[model samples]
Target chain A: MEQWKKQWTPLLPERVAEILERLPDDAPLLEIRLRCDRPLELVFDGSDRIVYGNNKAPIVEENELKALLRRLTGYSAFAWENERKSGFITVGGCRVGLSGRMIRTEDGVLGFSTVSGVCIRIVREVKDCAKPLLPYLLCGGRFRSVLLVSPPGCGKTTLLRDMIRIASDGLYGAVPCRVGVADERFELSGDANGAIAFDLGTRTDVISGISKSDAAVRIVSTLSPGILAMDELNDANDAKAVSEARGKGVAVFATAHGADGKDLRLRPAIGALLDAHVFERIALLEGVGRLTSVTDGDGLRVDAVSQ
Target chain B: MKTIGIALLFALCCLAGVRLGAKKAAPLKMIRAMRAGLQSFSDRTASGATLADAAEPADDAFRERLSVYLESLSQGSAQADAAGRASAAFGASDAVRSGAELFFCGLSDAPRAELQRRIEAFGAVLARAEVDAENESKQARVLRSAGFLVGTGLAVLLL
Candidate 1:
């Protein structure tokens, strides 16, 4: 109840709050998605259930969606102008995706003019989720650069986040390092105050609200981090940044939306990096829990029982 | 001596009535000031200033009142919404109050195009308010002038 109260209560309106309060403390809620003037639903266990619509539930007005957006953004549309153009904003330590017409100038996207839909993704910190991956991620008393491979929604981001925390905190007799996390989307850290909104451990530096490749290069040059972590690398720019960091001898822990390590080898730029042996260990995330397999730099699976 | 004292008193009373008449005839001047404040706000906004900074009026008195309204917004109390805040800016008329509120709210976080539209709408409302005030002032002037003439006649008769 406290967990639910801490995460959601202050954000919901009175009517929505009342309805959510009626449910049990453990609701197994994944998301609360809304498209303007459309039905509101709760995403749990990969199913969409109506959030508020019964004889008891209060009917929502069209303006309610608009009101929610203002509240979530703290009524500062000016500050979030860039994020709106990108079609999302991270608020209340959760990710809120927006969709609408694009606003662009000669330079690039400015922001959204009108937001019509919102998708709220609820993120929770799972303690010790990376416990099993530690041995494969470390070798000969040194941290090995790891790349997590998984398709979308396979929970790769969550796993990488925990691993960063574990590395920063030096859990399970491992050495602690000055870890740098480039959370480009503000998704992994949910920070606005120049500090991480989540528990990234004492030695972790989380920088967000910037382009992915640029952030990576900036952290590598300026932060002097012992290790680097990033979420969801795509395209040649990201591959180049990863190679740059690896050249600087900063072990990189990152995630990519790929089903398997060999699968990623077909993509030209990424395949080039793989061929160059940039990654020492690869963990391919399965549906929701433990990784399906952890492969070494040679693209060979390692035995869990071995040293 | 007593006769002279009575005559002097009558003259003083007549002068007071004339002064009242002059005060009543003064036109509603605030309408122009309000329009000017909005113009300054727009200029500031265009220069890439935040709404709070842009809405900071050039007039010292208006700036003080706006600060109070801003403080209330930051505190996020139900007691003071945008409408309540704008009430302190213009006349007590609901039209003026609502228009001011709409203008202020637009300045808070609106896009540039939206802000421009609200500003224009507010300007129109302000113009109407100016006309209304002018009409009222004209009627007040007529009443005060009539009072002055009547007082003069009464004083003349007394003397």
Candidate 2:
């Protein structure tokens, strides 16, 4: 079993862990969600199952859920205040989503007064997954500024991560470059037990725990990276940062939450990027790790084979 | 031989008094260590260390209890329940037990500023208790000297 998968077992209640451990090592588990007094949900690659105890679905007690949160935060909630406010905490490269009674004040969201639900999303490195898309993403033997468009949970981040690794490592006839990753959520370059969770290639420099714009500007000024990789360009600041970096002669590999070019243009920030033709290639993803098609910045179809 | 036995008895009484005095003074020392420990813990937590990592610099007794609490947390026990169990280690003092329980409550989820504020508030409580402990320690010293004088008087009367 992958170490990341094993990390979840210890955080779960004993009975749930026992039930989960019964699955095969390669069970393709995608998520483990726990709700207070509700049945445990296990999401696999293509299916979801509810685990039962005795005759009915095992219930997650309130205390058990809180304890799980404590363990996830390493029993130091003060340290993860920002992440808690963001409604998620990353542990061992797995993004644990939290939901509960949010305490709000005049300033904004204070934090969770009581966490009632937790969703642990399992993430694994799909090595060389970007190999086939490399040809289309490259132009004239040089990497193009590409934007990966996908719906939620459609593996846009995973593909973008693999693409960054491939470009940084210069593997399989790809151009090598110093890649600066603006990991706003720490999801791109997660840490597990004080160690880097994923192999992002030797040339990748990651800046996390800051906004994408600040990290991008800092990376460009300090590291002078040839390529900048960031996940989820959602706001104007992100789009402007990517545009500014591109203008400065740095190629960008970014992912956006959208299904196609139409979806991309529907959002104000993404539409501006599309209008400016910042990205030379726009790759659309359907299903997990499957590229459906590729289009140019002008919305013209780029004939390419899906990997 | 009888005189020597009387001297031995008087010496034993003085020794008992010294031991009792030391016991009375122990709380003051313990509280001082706890204050220092909490400062260190705050520093470590500010630097993004887990409670287990920060617990090493705590007072010996509190560290052991905190270890148990952390172990209970790892075993999936609720924060309140774990703190309840850990606070039982301060069996001799209800004030200390309650203070410890409050210290452990919701600490895992407290923000950095809130944590610092809590520590300062707890430090105030500890400061007051420290004053009380210091007074008790002084009283204990007086009690010990009185016991020694009483022992001497009894021995002289016997002579």
Candidate 3:
């Protein structure tokens, strides 16, 4: 723990630490907003979602966020989770939601490229973020495959990262599962110096620098991990891999981008994944990192009791 | 001794006449030669001919005349070496001695009439050198006189 503390302390800038320190203790995650002349707005929901902003906001897109994560983490490949409407990185368990550009692909209409105004909602986990959602996630002493959905800048990834951490650390009532993270990008751990700067969990096996689809297949078959965490399941290959992982009884945690329930179905990739019935839960994150909606695998809305 | 004095006097007179003539003619002759040399070199270079191939019969005549003139100057004074005589006759100073030698050598096989004309021109220039030296001294005296006049006028005005 001391070694980890020493390792991570140098990796994080003083400004980032100051921002992290300003976060609310009760909040699952904290947001640090950057604006010109506008006071930094830090918003923390009781869940593992946080939103930081200023009044004069810069436009951020799903591709832009993916590019940022790629630059920040030096990940090789990036893709938009067209089916779930999210942005995926090849680094850590970091999934970011993107808001602009929907183009046509051979596999139908997936968010092809990002242009103009866009917002990237970066997902991460705080210790207390997954406390409420953990119980429902672990049913009959086993994990269920879940798909987190959110609009741009929502806390789907933050919630998912926390869920994975909690599950791996055995914070919830369930046993500590070997969480295999196909972090195509380094958003979750934001790893520097080959070590995870940010904590995912003790037992989580993070495989960075590979496609989510490929990592999913490898982890399910070879690693035989208890839970597979991947970000931004966009393409048909990604959907197929996730379905295959679920078929082998390996619980999968994934995120996607969308405005609402209706908009999610409009996405061709997400629509197909839904048809395939790969996920048991479709958790919808909304407004400033709030879990506004939660639905079961059948697309039926379920009430989430506020923490 | 009297014969030697008479010869010396005659030589001085001859030297003065040649020098006077050279003062007027040497510059023109040098200019003409330079122009001719440049034209010849250009013609040869353009025509893709070697120096030997480019040497016309008239050029050979000029070289023969220059050599005879140099030989005559060499006969007048043992004090003047072959090199000095060659320089005076052919306008081939130490810097261009090799070129002068090559020119004369080319003419060794040419006709005698053309060679005599070249010799006369060379002798005339060599004889004029003493007179040109004397004229130069006279010009320096004139310049000094002019400078002294100007200085005296300035001193008088200041007083």
Candidate 4:
């Protein structure tokens, strides 16, 4: 078998380009999908370094490659060594599953050691995936709270970001309203140096590096923004903040990782929000970026074709 | 020899004291001038006064000096505008076009000096704006606090 470095090195640029280029042409109009929805397994040592996996084996020495991997993941004290063979860090929102030596304790599995290999999956964000649903959202001349649901790497955040840009650009109607994005992770803006590089819009106010709940309150009260956006809604505090924003009449767009609408409705805080009718539309993304189904408050299917 | 070394040290200390004193005085003077300039600008702009209105009260000699400066600025702006339009029309890259446009549009001689000077002036304006915003918010807080105190007092008296 070819060495991991030899196989991956030549294909790295091509793979990156493919991810960026394969974005749905009718993004915002169609659902942007991920090619692999399954979580990729990542094997690492206690130091969070990549071990090895897939075609790659014979993991690199920790001393020589650990520093490089640290720079990539931005997290220290984590290392992966799969079966003491090969390893590399995965990019974007792709899952990195663990393997190798298991350190089991009475409480639970403490950690993995003597790592073997890892599987790196690529996650891509296609633009304009939500374009078809824009009219339905803005049908009443007022924006509604939208909840986008999908499993991991399903392009929920990508759809949300485009929707924001669209709303800010006023692509559907008048001048874009003020949008406040509470991006806890640097995913939406992809800003490394604490400033938004892209033109989200003149009216967009981005407060990166803060919890969604805190950002929502700050934007709503201080910025007096019209719309609020966030990704990975998990906590009760986040739900509470969303509820408060809804009460204040601010439109919200958020995404979460879930298998289906029913699965989404089962989450504690998420279920509460749904029960309270926090979101006007629940869009279910499936099979990568395909929009499998969309439902209204009554759980009735809305057969709106996306462009 | 020890006596000589002590004397030399004293002389060095005296020299250092003089140098430090001079350095401190210069910065203090600059700070005072900056404060005075800010105050003058604020006073002129206050009470519904425009830049033109403020300039009107100056002596004829000052007005003549101002006119010459304004004329030079206008000519510079004209040249800049021509360059900017040409670059834009030629469909140059964004970097080139923006650089040309900013050179002519953002640096027009109305504010005086060259591009670098205008940028410095803009920085000062931004600083002043921040300070003004801070002061306004502070004043609002004071007013709110006073209102709260009065309301509490009134409520106590009514009870």
Candidate 5:
């Protein structure tokens, strides 16, 4: 079976799974969206289609969605409580984003009261995706701090994962060094039952199922990594952690949600890192593993500079 | 030869009474084992283990009884199917069996607090059942003794 089918099919209704299994082997299936009383939607490469059952659109019930959530979490909501708070569950490197009623208190949001919709993002590893930009990222045989910025569904995580693998494995003439991965949601590590599904290279040390800041600190202090890699640098705390690690001479490899560097500067958290020149290079992705441009710390195009 | 035949008849009656007595007490033992196993399952799951990983029995007896269910769950069998298999493997009374069926069916369908509450509630039910079974077993013991005595009396009269 394909990776996506093996990882995701069991988490869906049987009817839906049947429909998904019928898809061609080469289908570029991207996302599977399930909404209560709505037709099942399959997002392919740059397109989407509503699936039907018995000649009519398959309407999912609220109970089915809940059951699916239960199955995805291996029937232990408590085990996945942290992921629930984040409104997503990471399974085998694929993220299942959830939409539901928020349970809030005077303190803050507690968790979901009910899940109404689910979106499973399909993630596939593309080896050597970062090979093109490795030259700019490495200078004088030392890895430079690079932050990948892209819009949602543009493959930032995929690219970041490959870069980590290559960096840790010493691929393409890059010297192999210790890389510590703070896989807060288990996305980078694909950890299931304490076993890692992804090949993050033998030299990589991944600390998962914990907060990024805590994991980063623990990884740095204990693992003594030469490169510290993390995903989704969204908040000030994350930026602070990355900055602190960089200050300690660990090269930071991270990804963030933004259209480009300009969009990134609008966010005060990441903007602070940019202003402090925390990252030596910023790669803006156009699409899946496709980099539109690479810029230096001062926002100058590295390709242009080389020319 | 007649005396030996009479002795064999009395022994058979005593064996029958003992077997009946054990049958009457089986449910209590089964329920006790289930309660202990469920408690372990609840604690392990609360500590972030998956259903299959946490489905450990408290002792050897329950472990042997739950082997089929555990194997099924670990192999990714549907929750309902696994629970069914467990229910079939348990040769307890109807009431105890039904209660266990409810627990296994709902195991994977609720939040932690809800699940914990349900387990406690089921445990209480089992506790009450154990008391009832003890009282029934006491009655069964008397009946079993009387049955043995009555059968011996009949054999002696026949001789």
Candidate 6:
């Protein structure tokens, strides 16, 4: 087996861990999405490929999910209160999304009352996945603000990550720009314990475990990055923050979840950002090897970056 | 020689009675300390302290048990495993032992209020432990004093 595949070892319960290890070597294990009481299925080889780990496929219990979270957060329930409330946390570069009943008070959401499910999205950095799309994202010899669009699980994160690395380390005919990553979920940067587990490249700054909206504005003022990269802009506050940063002339490389270019224009938040000209280029991410539809700031489908 | 021997036995009897009394009383002190530790834990948890950093500096024995529990957790041990290990290391009765486990086990994906509540409930466990320890200690105290007196009376009668 390749050494790179070993890095995807999720901190699963012992029973599931043993089952994962027994998977056939030829199995193209892309992601392992687990939910409480749901049968464990492996995503690989296709858009929705499923591989059975066990004939009985042990049901994931609430206790098991709690155990997993305890292990992932190093048992720091207090420190992870916000993430727990938000229903998502990143551990070892994988985004662990959770589902639970929201516990709110007079002010706002306090935390979760009862945790129910967990989906561990394994982040695989597909190096050079941006090679074809890099041209559309660059104009002449400098970076342009590009927003990656895709429905959830369509490889937007994987592509956006590679693009950031390329822009930070320098790509073909383009100089290495000072890149700042606002990694709210720790998915893009893969940084933990003051040590970067993933090689983003030389001269890349990442701020994790903060709201992307805050990080977007702060990274510009503090890091003064030539290009600001982030993932999943959702809501008016995030759009407002990114627009203000782009107004400062710092090119923003970010992503959003949507079906297509039409969906981008339909979404109220993206429409607001587009009207302000925050994004110069928008690329729609599809399955692996599929072309990414590149559109101009006006949401017009201009060209397709071939895979 | 006989007079000296009687005096020595009497002194030994008195010392044994005192030791028994101290044994009976020591658990109450430990129980109070545990209660204090629970309050600190509640305060710390309410302040959003991380499990690794939430150390309530109580008595030496309590702190030692907490360190073992948190260290095991920090080292990536499962909740039950870490809690069980800490409980096993505790030199106390079932109530205190299970209380230690409950303390660590409650550090799940729970909110500050829930965790604080868990610590609040720990007081009952400490109270129960104190009662059990006190009962054993009281039995020992009675046995020591009464047995010494009975032996001494029998000795005098035999002489």
Q: What TM-score, over all chains together, does every model reach?
A: 0.70, 0.84, 0.44, 0.48, 0.84, 0.71
**Candidate 2 regions with alpha-carbon error over 4 angstroms:** A50-61, A139-142, A193-195, A303-307, B1-25, B56-62, B76-80, B90-93, B109-114, B135-159
Worst 10 residues of 4 chain A by lDDT: A29-38
- The fraction of reference interface contacts (C-alpha pairs within 8 A across chains A and B) present in each candidate is 0.25, 0.89, 0.00, 0.00, 0.56, 0.58
* Positional deviation of residue A90's Cα in model 3 after best superposition, in angstroms: 9.5
Clashing pairs in 5: none
Instruction: Give the C-alpha interface root-mean-square deviation per candidate.
Output: 3.7, 1.3, 40.9, 25.7, 2.8, 2.4
Q: Which residue pairs clash in candidate 2?
A: A77-B108
The iRMS of model 5 comes to 2.8
For residues A74-138, what per-residue lDDT tens digits would candidate 6 score against the true structure?
Answer: 66676678877788767777877878788889988887777777777766667887888866766
TM-score of chain A of each: 0.88, 0.95, 0.63, 0.67, 0.94, 0.88
Per-residue lDDT of model 1, residues B1-159, tens digit only: 856775666666667766765554443566667777777876776764455566665454345545655566555533237547655566536787887777666344576677678878988987888788777677766766666676667667767
> RMSD to native for every prediction?
7.5, 3.9, 32.3, 24.2, 4.3, 6.9
Candidate 5 C-alpha lDDT tens digits along B1-159? 988888888888888888888888777777777778878877887777866577653655555545665556556677778778776766656666666666666566566777788778767777878888888788779768976997789797988
Candidate 3 per-residue lDDT, tens place, A42-67, comes to: 43453343333345343333333333
Clashes of each: 1, 1, 30, 51, 0, 0
Give the least accurate 10-residue stretch of model 5 chain B, judged by summed lDDT. B57-66
**TM-score of candidate 2 relative to the true fold:** 0.84
Give lDDT: candidate 3, residue A219: 80
Put the candidates in DockQ order, highest first.
2, 5, 6, 1, 4, 3
After aligning candidate 4 to the native by TM-score, how far in Å is the CA of B25 from where it should be?
26
For residue B35, what is the lDDT in candidate 2? 74
- lDDT scores of the candidates, listed in order: 0.72, 0.83, 0.54, 0.53, 0.81, 0.74
**Could you tell me how far off, in angstroms, the CA of residue B108 lies in candidate 3 after the best superposition?**
77
In the range B76-132, model 2's lDDT, one tens digit per residue, is 677799889887776536787787788777777777887888778777777878898
Q: For residues A42-79, could you state the per-residue lDDT of candidate 5 as single tens digits?
A: 98877889976566755688867877887787766767
Residue by residue across A165-230, what tens digits does model 2's lDDT show?
888888876768899999877788886545556889889998887888899989988999989998
Sort every candidate by lDDT, greatest first.
2, 5, 6, 1, 3, 4
List residue ranges in candidate 4 displaced over 4 A: A1-56, A59-61, A73-125, A303-307, B1-159
Task: State which docking tier applies to candidate 5.
Answer: acceptable
